[model samples]
Target chain A: MTLILEYPNTQLKECLIEELQLQCTSWRFAVEANNLSPWNRIPEECANYIKDYMTGKGYQFDLDRVSNEAEIYARSVELKGDGKDAWIFDVDETLLSNLPYYAEHGHGLEIFDCMKFDEWVENGIAPAIKSSLKLYEEVLSLGFKVILLTGRSERHRNITTYNLIKVGFHDWDKLILRNPEDLKKTATLYKSQKRDEMIEEGYRILGNSGDQWSDLLGSSISDRSFKLPNPMYYIP
Target chain B: MTLILEYPNTQLKECLIEELQLQCTSWRFAVEANNLSPWNRIPEECANYIKDYMTGKGYQFDLDRVSNEAEIYARSVELKGDGKDAWIFDVDETLLSNLPYYAEHGHGLEIFDCMKFDEWVENGIAPAIKSSLKLYEEVLSLGFKVILLTGRSERHRNITTYNLIKVGFHDWDKLILRNPEDLKKTATLYKSQKRDEMIEEGYRILGNSGDQWSDLLGSSISDRSFKLPNPMYYIP
Candidate 1:
């Protein structure tokens, strides 16, 4: 350890970079585990790391693994044929890919502008997350009704629907979004309340999937809620 | 991508190995997220990865990061000063480091023998995880009560206590272990019941920290639960 402290200038520089990488890796773990919630943006130092992570194969691989497990869980469940067996899916990062927008704008906390995001939504060009699309298709084939619960506002309903369909997400039983009055409520409370209404209507929530913990956490959550990784941001 | 498939033999072998590593990394993400629950062992291909992760700086760095966040969370709360603010910790990987045994035995599915594990526990030489130890001390200084909860059977109580005290863990208000009849229940149910009893007695659980999901999940879990990464094993 003493010898390392005596390292040459070049080695010291290398050590600093490595230290930064390790710190970022740890932050990623905490972010994914929900230990660091109520966070809006990734640490500024981790901007490049987050960009590489989202653009590189790691993000897709993580999604693929989670989706595979979701399929396994779906297969394990003997779905009731009563048409009340529901699978909850969160929109933005869960079913739709906002990667292009995040990619172009960068993740340095500057790109999260509300107006800019709304403009992206209006474009209706968000792609479908391939792994999620596969799970959506499989769960539907297995007789589970898909309920798309999103934090997006009701004003974006037309664009969200068009984009979802254009990007290969279709035949979902319901696309529930926030109403005008839900603007004051948190995503967790809003989604939870929506789920409660669904349960009251006799739907047995078998599986819920989302990139944000708020979507899968809180009251009325399903027994098998799968949290997909989103190291870029956190939603309570 | 197509050109890579036509690479020479040596390059093709490297490609295959890289693919295997990617698969293992994906598995690690799933394991950490608790998406792949009811799992007993890591994937065969991931054994080396797990060994490297647990032994290298990654594991310690993760612990350090989580512990630092735990401290931040602890400092955020103004203590009730009624001795009711309790911090829950799981015994095995949360407080003690079983690294020596896991390292020597090799995590190759063969090291999980019941008798072998019991023998290790009897030694009472397990060291305290430095990161956790720091948090343990800091929380105590911050006036939070430490409650050690474990799934270890009652038979290992004396040695467990010895190991903890020897490793500088003392003044803990309580150490909860499974009873003879509690063996029939899962760790989730058992720990939840204990927390419920604690609540009945007026303790408000402020934080829960564990390496296993079961330690922090279930009915009576805290809102500020920290899941320290343990890619080694999953105990439901």
Candidate 2:
């Protein structure tokens, strides 16, 4: 079972580690034997804690394919015609599921290990949610404009776009990544303003779907807004 | 000839009085001349300023009509059914032209004198703008709802509603007057929040037409936003 607690911060992380050392025999033995202290330098220990927490809970920690498929289907409705209005999708957990990698790494800070991620993308090993991928293909076939909007910093733009193409997201109009300076500010306000600016340039926002509130709240133009389930973790 | 200038504030009163005294030779002066200085003191001068401004700008201004029949005619569009989205009109320039009363009394800080306004409504003296009033009636007859959303305070709701009814605006869901407290905040945020709350309750806003930016900016739910001409004066 995968535990789906709201992702807590460093303070909670320390407490969880201390509690696990005192309780579960398996956890205590594994920690001492491996010299694993998530609270200390070992990042792998933290990943283990997350995995154990999930097993302690009742969930299977499966990636939600149904909801992701529904979103892509709904979004494809706008892409069916000459495609005057375009769709801009987020990357992580949206177009591609990153939970498995995160689960293995134990530390999100290390999840962005570009070399490993690039290799994964090159191999097309990162599985696409079948329904969502089908919907994306439908959108392209219908000729609606498609763009990718990601919170990933601009430095990752080239690799991200290349990876997306390699993974079958083709014929995109643009791939937008965050400016480094903008990432320092509240993420929500930054995305909203960018969306609004796009709308003002005459792109009708038929729909906006994202896991975080910041992605949708700033744009005044969206005809509809959808929130995807993000039970595994949260950013803000 | 009527000599209308922008509504005179205290500082502008002396200059306005001088200009009016020199230019308005055709119409006999009705108000007490001694009270004309410090513009706020002379309600009659203020009224004249509004009237002359309208005339100079080629916008027909009427005072006696309780309803803007002409405006209603020009603005009405047909909807699908008898069920209609109503327009909540503000009384001052939106429905009835208040220039005659303003011209006679000047602009004063006194609360709106509804008894006097009631007499005008009862008289039905103001002729409607043929196009606008026709639009209003067309909208009304087509089963679109007509609402009166005004900046008038709560104290004036009864009289305002009565006056609207007296002027042939008999059917409406509600007359929303601004709360006195709402006047203290940023008009944009206050109006937007209120409109959003109303929309949350399931009202589909087809369009919102108003002369002030405050009125139009307050509601984000409307399908379309229209700004009426307000060339003669301004509120802020």
| A1-236 per-residue lDDT for model 1 (tens digits) | 77766678669789888778778877888887877847767788888888877887778899998999999999989987899999999998999988888887776345468798899999999999999999999999999999999999999999999999998888888999899999889898999999999999999999999998899888887989898988876766
DockQ of each: 0.61, 0.01
Off by over 4 Å in 2: A1-83, A106-126, B1-236
**Candidate No. with top lDDT:** 1
Model 1 residue pairs with clashes? none
Once model 1 is optimally superposed onto the true structure by TM-score, how far is the C-alpha of residue A192 displaced, in angstroms? 1.6
Best prediction by TM-score: 1
Q: Candidate 1: misplaced stretches above 4 Å?
A: A1-14, A108-111, B1-17
Error of 1 at B76 (Å): 0.4
Candidate 2 per-residue lDDT over residues A1-236, each given as its tens digit: 12445445556987866555323322222221111112232334444554553333211211233234334545446343544576666676566666566566553425346577555544534545444456566655656566667777787666676666666777777677889777786656767777777777766666554644455445463555434433234443
